[model samples]
Target: SLGQFAISENGGIALAQISNHYLGNFGMIILALIVIIACLKTTVGLMSAFSETFVELFPKKEYRFYLLIVSILPCIFANIGLTKIIELSVPVLMFLYPLALILILLALLSPLFKHSRLVYQITTAFTLLAAIIDGLNALPASLHTITFISVIINFAKDFLPFFSLGMGWILPSVLGFIIGCLCQITITVYKNKKSSTLS
Candidate 1:
């Protein structure tokens, strides 16, 4: 079924093909409806949130204006074809994934770290640098040919572990967290010693 369709052309084509093959016309219709309904709700929610946030951030712009812009941009981009949109989004997603993962980890370990701002800042700073490198590495081969990008990629390949496997951010994030913890401890000790000496 999927063999008949070019799945690479559109992300949904393969899903549609599979549904049509196993359950015929009815399955296709159901799948279409499900996708439409899911997308509709998601779009509405995102647009509302985006417009509201922008309106607050830039009070000169009205909510409706922001909403209109957000709505129009997606429509224009959608015309570019799903494959192209996905190609553009991959690097962005790669850049964000590590940052998001680090945040989640920090939240989970907040109790142990005593919710120290230093830990969060240091860890995120290190992770951000590595994530940027990862995103650059994920860029198209043509972009990778650019001198600076190629140099960065080569440096990461030489010095960063698991970079080839796309797990390059792991070591940096851990090291940052450890360094942050040490800094926090040192600060606390210094403050305590200073207070004792003063007393």
Candidate 2:
């Protein structure tokens, strides 16, 4: 539900056409990725950066109550905002891809995010190219741990459709899990570094 309103009364069709064009097929999407990369922006980079920064200063695993109390409400609130925006006009949400793209950039670039501009630039560039490649390629399905976990989660979610919107909630839940795991690993690595330095 994109919350974008047409500036004029007759602009709804124009907006829909734009959204349709943008979300059309692989060729257009790949071209869009190329354009987005040429401009140096992505969702993964943004999310991972935020996650890293958040974990760095607030790395206390014991403060789950304080952290969840403070964080969960905002996330839920944001989801509500998204739901309302979707209600406004789902088509415009496609153009609102920047936020989601930034999160994707964060997740993809997490392998390189740190306290260095050089690292951020390198990771950002790498993530841009990688994302473009991912967009172009049909990623092979593998029988790996992520695959197994996804399958089991999908199976479980099948019985719990009440929590799902329309389709299974597995996709969004899996994405959230992936981001969470990335943050967890980053924090774990940070903890190990501190331990080594102390040792």
Candidate 3:
């Protein structure tokens, strides 16, 4: 049973424990091999993408240099252990996930909005603000005691709808989108009127 496996800071241990219990040493070996292959493929893909992007952005830097930096940094950071890595990543993931979701939503609704950059920018700006607050809230408990962060968290909880449920960004994002659509309509109308007057 899953409950029989001891819990640890590294959640992956449970899977290993389960496999080992069910199938003995061979199962553990196979699981480890699978994990290694998975990690290797992911690392390679990420490194290649990062290196290519950096090379384009900074043409002076060679791809090899970027690859080396990415490789070395992760190697160094990996020494911190899985628990620490997860702890550091949680807040960052919290911050990015909402912005990513909002961008995807905007893309899907682009036809209705005529793919207006103004609409995307305004909505993204609002979502970014809320995402920042959520990220701060997700920070380590020790950091929560900081006066400014605590104040911000308290303020969000008091006013932002669904904040306690971690969906506070929803209302603001909707409002921004509506406002963006209105601005786009008003600008389009003004442009048409000016063109008509000139003709």
Candidate 4:
């Protein structure tokens, strides 16, 4: 709920403006209080999550150590400023979101494939490759301007369906899944035939 408020604060302000037009000063004060509280709550929750992750990752390190690191790290990022952080994070989020989605979708559909490792491996490999390319495309202009990267980006845009939509992985992942299923079926048949001949 705190996260939702943080994300929707701009829209909440729009609603507050409409209320302020009719309710005058009282509505504005209430909106201001709500916004402040929501921001504080969300920030605390985010920091807690970050610190906990680090603490868990480094089991031998004391919780206080990870907590201190997490607390201090954000100050450095804040000194770098919010806009720059957003600029850097947006590209990474763009790159990661597709792979995340594929994993989630595959997890949900796992039972349909009988939890096949071949299917998982194949789909994940294709998704990873596409995600890496998409991530490279999202790099800062100087990095992206390299000749090899530019050519690869151009080739992907020209040849891959949905590359422009940040969904370049979909077709390839699906193809990989299909191919993997086929391979699994062929292998299973071969195994059965070999066992039958041995018997």
Best lDDT among the predictions, by candidate number: 1
Residue-level lDDT tens digits of model 2 in 1-199: 2345444333434444455566766645666566568644554455446566667777864344444554565566556554354444442333233235645655675565433343344334433433332222212234223665455545534553432232223334344445555666677789999999999
Position 152, candidate 4: lDDT: 84
Order the candidates by lDDT, highest first — what do you get? 1, 3, 4, 2
Per-structure clash totals for the candidates: 0, 19, 0, 0
Model 1: clashing residue pairs?
none
Q: What C-alpha RMSD separates each model from the true structure? A: 1.9, 20.6, 1.7, 5.7
Off by over 4 Å in 2: 1-14, 19-41, 62-199
User: Candidate 3: worst 10 consecutive residues by lDDT?
Assistant: 1-10
- Model 2 deviation from native, Cα RMSD in Å: 20.6
TM-scores for all candidates? Answer: 0.91, 0.21, 0.92, 0.76
Q: Write the per-residue lDDT of candidate 3 for residues 1-199, one digit (tens) a residue.
A: 5478556667677777888888999999999999999899999999999999999999998999999999999889989988899999988988998899999999999999899999999999999999999899889999999999999999999989988877778988998899999999999999999999999
What stretches of model 3 exceed 4 Å from their correct place? none
CA lDDT of 4 in candidate 3? 84
1 or 2, greater by lDDT = 1
Positional deviation of 27 in candidate 3, in angstroms? 2.0
